[model samples]
Target chain A: MTLSLDLSHRFQGFTLEAAFTAPPGVTALFGRSGSGKTTLVNAVAGLLRPDRLRLSVAGEVLADTTAGIWQPAHRRRIGYVFQDARLFPHLTVRQNLLYGRWFAPKSPEAAQDFDRIVALLGIGGLLQRRPGALSGGERQRVALGRAILSQPRILLMDEPLAALDEARKAEILPYLEQLRDELGLPILYVSHSMAEVARLATTVVLLEAGRVTAAGPVAVMLAQPEHAQSLGLREAGAVLQGQIAAQEEDGLTRISTEAGPLWLPRVAGEPGRPLRLRILAQDVMLALQAPQGLSALNHFESVVEAVHLGDGPGAMVRLRAGDAAVLARITARSAKAMGLRPGLRLHAVLKAVSVAQENIGRGA
Target chain B: MTLSLRVSAVATVVSLPLGIAVALALARGRFPGRQLLNGLVHLPLILPPVVTGYLLLLTFGRKGWVGQWLDQWFGLVFAFRWTGAALAAAIMAFPLMVRAIRLAIEAVDPKLEQAAATLGAGRFMVFLTVTLPLILPGILAGTILAFAKAMGEFGATITFVSNIPGQTQTLPSAIYAYMQVPGGDAQAARLVLVAIVIAMAALLLSEWISRAVARRIAGT
Candidate 1:
């Protein structure tokens, strides 16, 4: 099931007009702050009516301004997990979770079992406690459970983890992954955190100002230099599709990709289980000739596809190694010295430890 | 003292729903004349009590327009009667109640209501299940304030209903009546102590209730 949005809304000093489809699985609306991601999500949830909208969940049309058809938010069956959790402080956690269930008619398939969700979110201990007593992460988890119990056709999470610290965000991620794989429910996740989007989103819609600058499969979207530049040099990276091949005794795991077998720090995936690794652009270095390894364990023979020069001394080099697309960030001086241009045969080198544990996630 | 208690309690109860409705409108409504409505509700707070009383008498006297209409239809009258004392007290206390409740409503996060709406709750349901309960402590404080004000109201009550013994006489009016005659200091002094006791008890009860409600909502 997919949620499609083609809407336009005018705001003072800013206008948000976007059209994008949230494909099955986690489709992330990735953008920096003040990019209007939340407002777009609100339009999908029917909380904010856009000036013009044609939104549908699965095949049911929730709103189409031109068609003169609109549904009120309460009847739309969209489960929204806000950034702040927004849990009713007066109600116990159990009551908060069950609050929405009372209003939604449950089909056998849509009816998420109460105890199972409590277990899924690990919130059974908080059932009797009010929202005020829960920590930030716990509150968000309860909010997610509450939204699910409402039996929504699709889930809309607007930067639900944005308020949490890194540790708290890490704590909630595994549960979110489990929700994606187990529930088979499509979700529209909005976030400025590229790491979260890279880890969870199967599809990426990059929003800038109030418009979608790019949209595609996560792997393709991550390779786009336009959004990569906007994401800043630190988060600019490419995702490599690979499967774990072996676990070396020296605490390194072998992952086989189309490019070649690469060794990295031990990951949790079992042998033969596929995984996605995000190699930062800066972590990769380009060599004009076959480079002898000093300490870098991974280097691939590749051809330069594009060179994007930044305003400063830095440049992003897009390379094609076998079937994989690798990105290398280097100084413009080196590119000019090496005459790095499209179709130039070269080597893309990477430090194995440079791919931090946070940069790796299980395959979708 | 019993008459005073009855008048204040009756006044508070009668005006509770209206007070909440008006407060909600003042806090959230954006309709035309909203400012005018706010100013009118607060007129009794700033205007001299006697002036407010005079206006009420003109509007609700036995032969007054609304009073005559009510008398003919509902057979209800508020002239020189205990009911008149209650009406005058309610008017005098309206602004305090509305102000407290409005502040509470403003303190509530509208984001919670939006969350409820996404959960399939309509506007009214959101209010009943979330907004109303979340603001429960505020509402109680507002009610207690209004009741206290009603208990102490003398000028408006006297001018509107007059201090008729056993009928329109409340605590403050009775105290004033005692002071008007010589050698009635003992009665007036005793009533003054009674008023202090009643006010103290009310303050203590409100404190306890506020603490209990706050603890429940805050989960401390």
Candidate 2:
């Protein structure tokens, strides 16, 4: 299924004009705060009326301002999981989960399997409790269940984990991944964290100041040197699709990537399980020649594809390793000294310990 | 006492839906005539009770426009009847009821309502399931206040419906009637004590009900 949206709205200080079509899977709207991610999602949910909008999900027209057809939110059948879990304070968790069913369209396909949803969210224990009593993660789980029980045509999540603490986020991320994998539901996930986008998104639509700067598959988008600037210099990175090749006897796991075999601290997974690794540009170093006696475990022979110089002393160099892309941030002085240019071959070195466990996820 | 209770109860019950409607509108609506509607709802509180009664007399009295239609068609007369006392009391207590309910409604977070809508609930369903349940404390407080105001309403009741024993004579009117006769002081004093007792009981009952409902809604 595909979800397409084209909308333009002028606020007091900001104007949003964004259009993108997302294929099935998690399409993340990635931007900084006030970049209009939430506004775009709200317009799609029918909560906000834009000056001009045309939105449809899997061939069903949700809104068309030109035709004077603006479906009310209740009839749109689009589920929204808000940043703050807005569960009914007066109802028990079970009631809140079942609330959407009360007004849901009466059809066999619209009916959600209650037992399966509760089990999927692991909220069966919370059924007797109220929202005020649930922890943040539990509340979010209940909210997710409530939205799913509505049998929406599509799901819109607006920074669902932004309100949680690190521990709570860790507690909830696995459930989100399960939803993404098992539900087969088209999810528009909004977030500002590069780590989340790298871990969860199948596609990324980069937003900058209310405009969509770039949109493409996750691996390709994150590797673009121009797009890295908009993704924040600190978060500039490339995603590598790899598989667990072996677990060595010396407390290390080998991952086979297009670049080459990468050895990292042992990660929990069976051999041959696909994994996505986010290698931040800042964490990579370049050598003009294959260096000797290097402590770093990862060394990939690559050719420099492009050099993007920042305003400061640093420069971001994009390299192609076989079919994969890798980014390295080095001082301009070093780039000048090495005569770095497109098509120049070099070695990309990385310390295995610099790869945070938080930036790794099971890939599709 | 039975007539007083019946009149006040009917008035409180009758005006409740209108009070909630007006309160929700005042708290949530952004219409052009919002301030005018607010002022009109509150006019009875600022105007003299006698003048309010006179206005009611002009509109709902037997010979008045609405009252004439009611009398000719439905035989429902508001002038000099207990129903008129209830109507007058409802009008006088309306502002207080709306004020309490409006404050309660304003205290509710609109985001919860939006969430309900996204869950496929329509406007009225959202109000019924989310808004009304959340504001039960305010509704209880408003209803008790209106009931207490109706029980004690005398100036308007006496002016429009007059002090007719067993019909329009409420607690305050009965007390007023007893005060004008010799040796009626003891009876008037007794009624005064009853009024105080009933008012205190109503206040305590309202407090208990609201606290219970608040605790339930708050999940405390």
Best candidate (score: TM-score): 2
Query: What's the alpha carbon RMSD for model 2?
Result: 2.3
Question: What DockQ does every candidate get?
Answer: 0.83, 0.80
Per-residue lDDT for B68-121 in model 1, tens only?
A: 999999999998999999999999999999998999899999999999999999
Task: Report the Cα lDDT for candidate 1.
Answer: 0.87
What is the Cα-based lDDT of residue A120 in candidate 2? 87
Candidate 1, residue A186: how far the Cα is off, in Å: 1.8
* Winner by DockQ: 1
A1-364 in candidate 1: lDDT tens per residue? 8888898998877899899888788899988899999889898888888889999988889999999988999999999999999999888999999999879996574434888888998999999999899999999999999999998889999999989999999899878877877677889999989888877888999899999988998877777665677766788888777778999999998888877779888877679776667888888888877777467888889999999988889988888888988878889999999999899999888853233222124223
Once model 2 is optimally superposed onto the true structure by TM-score, how far is the C-alpha of residue B203 displaced, in angstroms? 1.2
Residues B75-187 of candidate 2 have per-residue lDDT tens digits of 99999999999999999999999999999999999999999999999999999999999888999999999999999998888888988998889999999889999999999
Residue by residue across A1-364, what tens digits does model 2's lDDT show? 7899999999987999999998888899999999999999999998999999999999988899999989999999999999999999999999999999999877675435888889888988888888888989999999999998998888999999999999999888878877887788889999999888887888999999999999999989988888877888888888887878999999999988878889988878879777778888988999998979878878899999999998899999999998899888889999999999999999999753233222234223
> Pairing residues by index, what is the TM-score of model 1?
0.93
